[model samples]
Target: MEQTYIKKILKTRVYEVAKKTPLDYATNLSRRFNNHIWIKREDLQPVFSFKLRGAYNKMANLSEDILAKGVIAASAGNHAQGVALSAAKLKIPATIVMPKTTPEIKVAAVQSWGAEVVLHGTTYDDASKYAQQLVEQQGLSYIHPYDDEDVIAGQGTIGMEILHEHSGKLDAIFVPVGGGGLIAGVATYIKYLRPEVKVIGVEPDDAGCLHAALKAQERVILDQVGIFADGVAVRQVGKLPFEIARTHVDEVLLVNTDEICAAIKDIFEETRTITEPAGALALAGLKQFIARENCNGCHLITIASGANMNFDRLGYVTERTEIGEKREALMAVTIPERLGSFRQFCHAVGQHFITEFNYRYADDEKAYLFVGVRLNDGLEKDRLIAKLRDKEYPVIDMTDNEMAKSHIRHMVGGHTQSLANERLYRFEFPERPGALLHFLTRMGQRWNISLFHYRNHGAAYGRILVGIQVPDEQLNELQNFLENLGYPYWGEANNPAYQLFLN
Candidate 1:
């Protein structure tokens, strides 16, 4: 069965539009990691992603009569562009159903490729359902983003190219997983051709569909997926890809948004090319794997999958990269509200660069300061925290705290003692025009919104920190409301970071 796929991969006619991207050695990354780091520059493709290979190959394999009927696909961005460009090149009409929450840049890109861009739903899964409906209604050929044999074979061509370019002993090859298409294809080829080369799949921790599926020994639908790495923010692993992945892929590594951001910085430093969060995922996973296994001097390969990033998203990436690389420390420190106290606190912090400092006069006795200080490494955070604690400053380490990182850092003022029965909850909803209003409307007038904070990270989903004044008697009602709201949320009422800074 594997041999048949190998043959199919060999015969994939992706070269009609897809370029054979280079396997460039990452010199700076290699030196830093003490390993031979090679990057498969798939981002250099015409569509700025590897999806074109699979999309074109899948469409190219279709009969001319079927092509005349046109094709339809549902994708957030990269895959949509792939299908659109492929259809344009083949002179086949294509209709791409994208989520309404998709970034405008991606929508414009798909439209530019001459595909009919239908904005629907709030997520790729939703768009997929709509696209499927069109496929049935119009008798259009549906080109799956992944899961198809021809598509997987087309992606497998990347593995073939990798092996051809670097036939040397490679310890591992890391591929970012979304629907498990890229990893499945690459892993199937690599494991068959070179069994010794560990084929690892990397996924965002918030969207660990592949990881969950692997653990469950079957494809499992995630309740919610993080849209930070939108290219790979799939709620469920593809059926066929998951099947292939389970058999061949060595491990699935979950990396956080910060780690992915850091990886993007790493790629930028080495190649001077900025990659999207999903594009840098494999590198982030490779770094984590190296640290966990303490392996060095080994040849490691990671695919830089795509560069179709919105220019605005860089702000969020830049903000998180330092913390991700252990080069920044965030803390909430309480000092006496006195002129001399500030001087002493700065003394304790020492010569470190202050990245952020937010303070408000709380009371006569004590004031809370939310601060970000630069650090050299992980040990520096411990030392800095220890120094602050030793100085008798009430210090709360906000490092690794999601609540602190996402909302509390920006919202440091207006802690209300008058607002009784206030419950804080962090919410994630599809980012669209009426999303927040829809949320507020569904919340109803029964509960008063005491506090609300929203920050756009240029992702498909919008994150909001909300404080609602709910009486103890209405706890069940609040639960019911949240359940019916159908949005991912977590009660941050008890979060220490919220208590330390925002409260």
Candidate 2:
């Protein structure tokens, strides 16, 4: 039962496994971060994760008669594949009960490995109950994802390999934590062998079960869980793993969804290998800790635990990375409706990329702008509004304003196709005096407004939705001159949603 001896068994299990996974040295990260860095590439393992090590050990430890009876497991995704593949290798029957909401790809993978896949429940708790019932009814072994000793010992093999391949001393090892089995095993083994080696655990900030449980000095259940990192989105840490991690883990770092996405992009750029959100978490944690603690020139290793990514989810990943880098931030800015107010709005900041600019006019209130700003290094976020304030313009920070970003930004781009040709859009904008009259003077009487919708929403600049009926041939010429005026505009008529619903 002593964990120190578990490493010996893990070594035996390592020989049993057929995968000689590479402990890839990260050349790019080492040079960029100025640290000796390497990746423990368990993401490239045969089962595409370290889960198989635990799953296989648990199965092999069973008695001959118990093995004949088969095994059952309930997992959201990764562990199901682990057990399915492990049992199939042992020539024993395996039945995997997964949440119905589990991604189609993981389901197909489990079935391909010859496991009977039963889609049940919307959450892991429900699927687990179903698996327990099956264990009782069929007298089959209930193989846990990480709650058993044998499983822990098997997963410890990774720590052994890490030390074997990464020579000399290690300043710290960052690992992604879910239910704590991986950390429990790796931390326990590492601390026993190298007491000074820091074993830091990373958990999704939205679902910090292990971190919470370890802090409480007992396993605790979370009332809610986040599914962004589906593989690590557990509500509670297992009791057995909790015990090991509580005493061994040096620290627990919590990272958000955006940070995890950025880390995923970073690793993909480095190795050209895609990792699930959960897998990228260790590296996210490392960057987070280094920044917080101001660490430099330390030997660091991050375990990339799995690679079971939902391919379709890449679009969401791409979207979040824009926001994560602060290269693109969403916020609402109010500018008065007037002649020069529009020009003043552009002059507030020295230079920044405009990702999106949407405006709508209502009730002569201020013209509202939903703006996205591109981020660059050394450009602190707080400085933007200060520069605008110097110009006597007001900007509202909505970087964390999820509702305005997700829902409003999409609707604001809708086309003006609903307006009749005779309708005129006049810029009654600019809250400052002499602004609207100046705008009219600059237009040189060439424009006629058929429809006018302008609002000075108590802001410096006002926006108006203008519709003009000109010769169809004049479209390109008028647009070219409008661009010279230095205001951003979108042609909503070309939006896909315009064609689908509005048309």
Candidate 3:
């Protein structure tokens, strides 16, 4: 199977559209990590992603009859662009089925390649189902995003290029895993050639299909996946890719969204390139590996998979980068609600820079303040916590608290004792004009909105925290309303941060 894949990858016709991306050295990263760090610049491809390599390779291998009939694909992201461009280059009429929630920028990009775009369902699964129906109805060839053999081989060419460009003592190669095609292909080729060099797969901690599958020893579906890194938010790994990964892949590492954000900043510092969340997954994992293993003077390579980032999302990324890098600590401090309380707190803070502070009048006895403190290193958090304790100021570490960081930080308003039946919920919906209005309309004026907080992250989705007043008897009705609303939501009534500051 290895030799078969090797031969197929060697003969893959992806160059008809894909570029042989450079395995460029990362000078700044090397200096910081005290190792030779290199980045495979797959983001420089014509489609701004390595997806084109696999998409075009699969399309090119089709028989003339199949090619003449045109092709179809389902993606809300890079794969759609890859197939669109590939179809244009092959002079075939292509149709891409994307989720209705897909951002306008991506929809426009796919259309720019002269492909017919069909906006369907609200998720990749919906789009994929619609694409399958279209394929059956129109006799179009389906260009899968990452599950086919030819597609995997096409991606294998990346590994071939990496080895060809670098002849140094290579330690490990980090590849971002989505549906597993990229890592599957790269791992196969690299392991076959340089058996000693580790092939590590990186995945977002919230969307770790590959990591879960390896641990379970079988392909298992994730009940829910995070959409922050929309590119690799797959719930399940491909069957074939999982099989390849079971043996060929060395290790799989998971990094949180904050870690991924930090990696994006790191890549920009090293190469002046902005990459999508999934694109930075490998580098994030690489950084984690180095910090954990404490290895030095070893050659490490990370794939910069794609650069098709939503410009609006950069603000959110930048905001989280400091926390992700462990250079900032978010703390919840309690002080007496008196004139000199703030001054005393400031004295305790001393030389540490306060990056953020949020306080609202809650009660006369005590005041809860949400604060962000700059840290010189990761170890500073423990020391700062102790320092505040010594000053007799009660502090809670809110850096790793998702609810506090995502919603509470933006909302520090005092709790309302009047609204005793209020229920707190967090929701994520597609970002578009009138989206909030639509939500409100569906909510109907029956229930009183006691509290509401929302901030635009500039991504395809909008996150909102809502507190609605509903008696216990009407709880089921509220559930029914949320279900009919057709958006992802989480009940946060028991959230600790909300209790500490708001409730």
TM per candidate comes to 0.97, 0.80, 0.97
lDDT of each: 0.90, 0.74, 0.92
Rank by lDDT, descending? Answer: 3, 1, 2
Stretches of model 1 off by over 4 angstroms after superposition: none
Cα lDDT tens digits, model 2, 1-503, are: 45544644555454465365677778888887777778888888777888988888888878989989999999977889889988888899999998765667788999999999998766678899999999999999999998888788878888877877876878999999988888988887788778899999999887999889878888888876666787888889988888778778988999887788888988898899999888999999988877777777888999999998877678667767766655677666667866676677877756887777876553253555667778774255667867776776656776655334333455564334444433222232323445446555666667575433454322123445445555567777667755664333334444332222122
**Residue-wise C-alpha lDDT for candidate 1, range 66-106, written one tens digit per residue:** 99999999998889999999999999999999989888989
Instruction: Please give the RMSD of candidate 2 to the true structure.
Output: 15.1
- The clash numbers for all candidates, in the given order, read 0, 34, 0
Which stretches of candidate 2 lie above 4 Å from their native place? 1-15, 404-406, 413-503
For residue 435, model 1's alpha carbon misses the true position, in angstroms, by 1.6
lDDT for each residue of candidate 3 in 112-137, tens digit (9 for 90 to 100)? 99999999877899999999999999
lDDT of 2 at 349: 58
